[model samples]
Target: MSHTSTAQKKLLSRVRRIKGQASALETSLEGEPKCISVLQQIAAIKGAVNGLMREVLEDHLRAHLGAPDISQTQRDEEIENVILILKSYLK
Candidate 1:
């Protein structure tokens, strides 16, 4: 199995929590929630997403880049892919 498969359950749990947070934010907006409450929910969702991204990115680095068995060319390709993704994500 792949490395991500090993952590699939944890990842899915995080995604579910994010979905719930989004739903809560939607509900709050539908009602008359305070501005602070909306901001807090948005921040919570963003933090959760960033945490999830960090976890997957770390796993990818370990599995794809840190593996000694892979060729240098393969490692270089993976590094370039990671850099491209990070640039797009940051933007």
Candidate 2:
């Protein structure tokens, strides 16, 4: 398959699974499961999102973010952008 197709498959698979987890979380609320179960579901969603981000960031870095043999200035720019991304999510 083409790269875009492969990437879409991966993303779609992850999102579908995440949707199921969210549904389970909602059902769990009806039964009044422990707080931990809710936390786990939330964590699973976060992890799914993080995995997607990792895949996208890797692709971006390989395709456009930086050269394999980037100059110092280019490397600095890429590093700064990555740091900014992390900071944005951490906030």
Candidate 3:
């Protein structure tokens, strides 16, 4: 099975948790929440998103770039793609 298929359940769980965090953040924003509380929620959401991104990036690197069966050209292409994405993500 593909790496994505193997991790689908875990990834989905993380996504669901992030969704819940977003919903809670929205609700908190709608009420008289303290500034610190709102900031903490925002931080939590950011951390969760970063964690998910890291997981997917690592998987992509391993599955697409590190696979021995693929050609060097293919690996170079994957590296370029990763670089482009990282540049955009960092921005």
Separately for all candidates shown, the number of backbone clashes (residues 3 or more apart, or on different chains) is 0, 0, 0
C-alpha displacement of 72 in model 3, angstroms?
1.2
* Per-candidate local distance difference test: 0.96, 0.79, 0.95
Model 1 lDDT on a 0 to 1 scale: 0.96
TM-score for each predicted model, relative to the true structure: 0.96, 0.66, 0.95
Q: Residue-wise lDDT of candidate 2 within 1-91, one digit each (tens)? A: 2444658877788889878888898898989799988999899988988887788778767754555776888878878988999899878
- TM accuracy, model 2: 0.66
**Candidate 3 least-lDDT 10 residues:** 1-10
Model 1: CA > 4 A from native: none
Question: What is candidate 2's local distance difference test score?
Answer: 0.79
Clashing residue pairs found in predicted model 3: none
Q: Which portions of model 2 show Cα errors greater than 4 Å?
A: 1-6, 67-84
Could you give candidate 1's per-residue lDDT for residues 1-91 as a string of tens digits?
3988999999999999999999999999999999999999999999999999999999999999999899999999999999999999999
The most accurate candidate by TM-score is: 1
Question: What is the Cα root-mean-square deviation between model 2 and the actual structure?
Answer: 3.7
